[model samples]
Target: MMMKKTVCMGLILCGMAFGTTAQTRGSLGQSDPKAKVVLDNVSKKFKSLKSVIANFVLKVEGANNSVSDSKKGSVYLKGAKYKVVMGDQEIISDNKTSWTYAKDVNEVTINNVDQSGNSMTPAKIFTNFYDKDFLYRLNGETTEKGKVLQNIELTPTDKSKTFFKVLVDVDKKNQTLARMKVFEKNGNRYTYEISSFTPNGAVTDDMFTFDAKKHPGVEVVDLR
Candidate 1:
């Protein structure tokens, strides 16, 4: 369940990071201008796209750097709507309502979108959230599979957060996000690798909502 929740949050973060204009509350004292420029380009590239479809792999590693679990998933995003499919869980949101479906139990839970406080909703974590939440600096570039990637290291300003540091890898050639790694205070690391990203993909509005009728014997739990 924790992994599912993390994936859901990561998907929402990715969708928002590229889908909308980011809000900046001014840069921190240690923030690097070079990293900001790279992030700005990424935001511009994503905002110009009509829609996005991405295939990603999630890896969970222990403190000792041993892989404990891994999962492959895909995310579909269009405007404020998104659908994430990973393993037996599917989280669908139409910007207003959300449905979490668990295939193993054949149950789906529905709830209204929460927009209050510091909720991890896309509305709250829109593009360039690092500008508001963390102090970031450029960590230079690295090559992976012949593609040049710009790496940026980020530290949270608020120590109360679960994750203490985040590493972002941007595809320098395309100015798109290629990967992200989150280091938690509890000695756990979560890495998300974007295996493939498709921009301006064809998508339908109906795809952002759950259709209980399609799943026979599936129980519905509405929390709205």
Candidate 2:
């Protein structure tokens, strides 16, 4: 039938397009030795911390090169648990159950925390994404706002990923992550800048869990 032929042709064309894109993406391998040293130091430092508190600014640039207003936010991390406060939404996770609280709607959506190795949560990126699933290269060092930052480019091993490249800027002086930028194949760029960081910050277990009883008349949507 003509309809069946058309569908077959569409599938073939889609496959061709995907093949072309995959050829242009970077493949995973060992990182540059210089870059490895920096990353290893950072990973060790992060693992040694009991908890961390930090303030960040997020900037999203669209495909057309139009940049959105930078949004300021805060993050609290203790092991796999984390609490992210940005805009009117507060995301809290105890590494088991995750709750997304929308202040505007006075409602919360509960979902199970993704335990997959490939899950790309903010906490995962801040602590462990570079350690696996990526091959990195030292893009050399750059001075940003008068601070020397070591720039590293990470290419995902999985070519099917929406984000093909990630750029991480580490503060050489303190050996801490200062900024990260994710480049998507769709031409969108996400930039996260860490303004301040405090390791071993005071955090209670209760801070990572959401109690609906505290919020009067709050609606809960259990998706888990």
The stretch of ten residues in a row with the least summed lDDT in candidate 1 is 14-23
lDDT of each: 0.74, 0.73
lDDT string, candidate 1, 73-127, tens digits = 8888887678888877888889889888888788888889765524354322224
- The superposed Cα distance between candidate 1 and the true structure at residue 213, in angstroms, equals 0.7
Question: All candidates' TM-scores?
Answer: 0.85, 0.83
Per-residue lDDT tens digits for candidate 2, residues 1-224, read 22322331222112112121222223344668888788887777888889999888877777888756577788888988888887677878898998878776788878897676434455555655565566788998999888999999877666787777889899998888998887879887777789999999999999999999999998888889
Best by lDDT: 1
Off by over 4 Å in 1: 1-28, 121-126
lDDT value, candidate 2, whole model:
0.73
Q: Per the 3 Å backbone cut-off, how many clashing residue pairs does candidate 2 have?
A: 0
Tell me how far the alpha carbon of residue 1 in candidate 2 is from the true structure, in angstroms, after superposition: 42
